[model samples]
Target: MRISRLYTLLLPAIVACGGEGDSTSTTTSDQTLDVDSIAAAVADQNLPSDSLNEYLRENPFDVDALIERADRFIRSKNIPYAEADVKAALELDSLNPRVLLYWGDVNFYKNQTRQSRDAWMKCIEVDPNNVDCRLKLAELYSIVQNYRESLRLVNKVLEIDPSEPVAYFIKGNNIRDLKGDTAQAVRYVQQAIELDPEYWAALDYAAVMLANMHDPTAEVYYKRMLEIDPNHQPTYYKMGMFYLDQEMWNESIAAFTKATQLRPSDAESFYNLGYINLELGVNDVAIDYFNKSIQARQVNHRAYYGRGFVYERMGDLIRARSDYQQALAYNPQHEPSRIALQRLAEKMAQ
Candidate 1:
């Protein structure tokens, strides 16, 4: 089963709810577990650029410093450096529950799912009341399509700390996937938002859920999120999509335009701009946007098809035929391109 893993689409937007827990273990289980060698052994061999020169020099072996640096590395897209720091922290205290949580993340993004799961489970074993670890496990389960287990883990987290808003959020996602119940999902996510009004992920999820039902309140959530962080490009894209679906052309164009401004290389947003302009009969502007979409990503068959349609409408059969052929070359299974090619052939024969 192919899991959507929507949460990973922009991890910086929705981070783990875990705290920096004490490295010391309270449990007697795994009393002789060799913790020092684990982190380095599990450190992923990869490369991205980051530097913690001052921190490494001053607090060479401090777990907190290493974890902080690792965090910086992860944010900078330097997974290898983050892993190295995790390894260093683990070597100092292999059973450091906090470091274990981070190690889970290091492996999770590395696509080492089992390793990530094991690290989180170890964190839970070391700190029985670690709600964050439980939540992480639940999220990982949800990512793998194990919604039942995800729910079970989330329930455990709630039992441990009823005030944990992220637990409710995770539970909401799992329930939505398991039962396809958007209304129920929205209720749980809304509960999370009520508990922690500043929870961005909860706000984003609730808005998306409400939008699924075409609920007008989704607009409120979108506006609130923009108020909180106007530069969040994904939110703008979502707002654009919502507006587009509602046929609010001006609003959609404005939102998508803002999205493109924030993320110039976003092919979909450019393509959407083209689509909207095309629908509005702004032929020249539509062509320009379509061309930009193709520039953003060369393999965009949709952009080719859209441009072909525009060309055909402009009575430029040659350009339309060329674009249709380009679309087919990119995606041989493009039905619209095939039909357009046939239609053009008949027109040319006339």
Candidate 2:
């Protein structure tokens, strides 16, 4: 079975939770800290870019310096330079756990999943107590639909640190996927949030699950998440979906409008807003939003179908037929468009 897009988004957070261990620290487990929080902390301590460049010039062969510079590159989303630094570090010490961890991060960002897994596995082999690597591997396994292996690794993480919020979050996802046990999944995710109320991933997952269960508390979780990170585009999209499910058209429109504002190029948000407007019998508004959706993604069959519907409603049969045909050209199996085309033909015969 294909994993849902919602679950797929969680993979990055799972893999990113583990950071490279500090070589000077006595315990290796400290290196497995949350990547975002660790990056924020390190950003304050990081040498300025010019200073790092000058230091690298003086000590070109220093492995720690190379990794530190690579970390800076990673934070800046410069994957190529980060990979080069990781490669340089690996050449100096092939078995360095920190370098291997960074290697995995770079590969993961580049969408080299197998390579990332290999790097993280090597890191674990070098230091079995690396909870971060284990968690990341579990996430990769889950992505590949190896739920049993994913659960085994996640359970190991819990054994190592029961309070680990990400571990609980993954456990919830695994249970939901493996057994369709949403109730149990919600409990596990709720535990994760209880452990760390500020965990945005867990909060979003919990809200989605609660919304699926038709629980009013889902809105509360969404509101809390927005309070924590107002600019999170995905949260707004999810909120729009939740309100759509509840048939709250105005609320859904508001949520999706915010999502579009946050991510102007995201065609899905505009498509959703168009759909809501269509449902509310606002044909002109729906057509305008659908046009915007198509502008954002020209190959969008749903947008074509939506515009076709609006044109048909306005008695413009020629344009309606053209759009329905365009929708079918994009997706021949689009049943609504197919049906619309057939009905248009029947009306023309009359």
Candidate 3:
């Protein structure tokens, strides 16, 4: 259950957009042109007015042009400008399916779920053949934990693009997370890979699913994902956990140590390292790692539990109880810490 919660916190970091080269020290001329065009489009639209028709009268091929503007504004996190751009595009071409789809995307980013759904509905109305919009709506629902709605949309996308790997990948993700049907999830992911061998997101999702399945084939998947994207943070963390689960202590320690080196303040890596060290009876090292883990995430119950275990082994009953109490304070159902607390209470009575 602790691992499950940890998975929730770590998912975004694993699937975050772009790589290290996403941001640049210098903007190129093309980037500057894109930004300027977008800013001008936003200025022309001037939301709160019905200026889209007038603007399009002057620039008839404006739908694609305005979309570029919206992209720039969205990337820059200029929400107001982005929203205006999307609205302007919609106003110019209300029947333009892609514009409506992007309107939904903008709303989704702004946390306007109902508005997003409305926009997606409009997109489907305009272009009943647009699978991408449906797929995106499904992903948005998944983000909010609306699995049933998500599944419906994804299934619709599959109906349109039968060979779409992403549709199957998302289907597998929802099944793996919500239903815990690992075997079915694994098969879906594998089918996705067979459809699109170079799909990195599908590969990454499959690697995680394989690891969770405790399958020996998980290493093959992880290594393949690493080959495609070496600096992927979640992949490293998952690899570490996989080794740890196998009780391959040295391999586990090395994987976790590398993970920490790559992401210095990651609490899970530190906590795992501390727990493993405590198990191996390296009390001083365990304490040091636990301290680092707590520093990274003060509320981490596993770090406190690992520290308590070390303290109990060292015959420090009072300190052990204190750490156990802290662990239970964070996670009441943490069985090891609860047992440690019970033993400490028995010792006190004796």
Question: Against the correct fold, how does model 1 do in TM-score?
Answer: 0.73
TM-scores for every predicted model: 0.73, 0.72, 0.72
Model 1 scores a C-alpha lDDT of: 0.80
Residue pairs with backbone atoms closer than 3 Å in model 3 (clashes): none
Query: CA lDDT of each candidate?
Result: 0.80, 0.80, 0.73
Model 3 scores a C-alpha lDDT of 0.73
Query: Candidate 2, clashing residue pairs?
Result: none
Per-residue alpha-carbon lDDT of model 1 for 1-350, expressed as tens digits?
01112234245322233323222222222333222332332334322212344445655788987787667656656566567778779999999988998888777666656777899899999998887677778887776677898899889888887877888888898888899988998989998888888788889999988887888899999998999998999999999999998999999999999999999998899999999999999999999999999999999999999999999999999999999999999999999999999999999999
* Model 1 residue pairs with clashes: none
Q: What tens digits encode model 3's per-residue C-alpha lDDT throughout 25-121?
A: 2222133333345446556656332354345446756787676656655555565556666677787888787787777656555555566677777
> Distance (Å) between predicted and true CA of 64, model 3?
1.5
Residues forming the 10-long window of minimal summed lDDT in candidate 2: 1-10
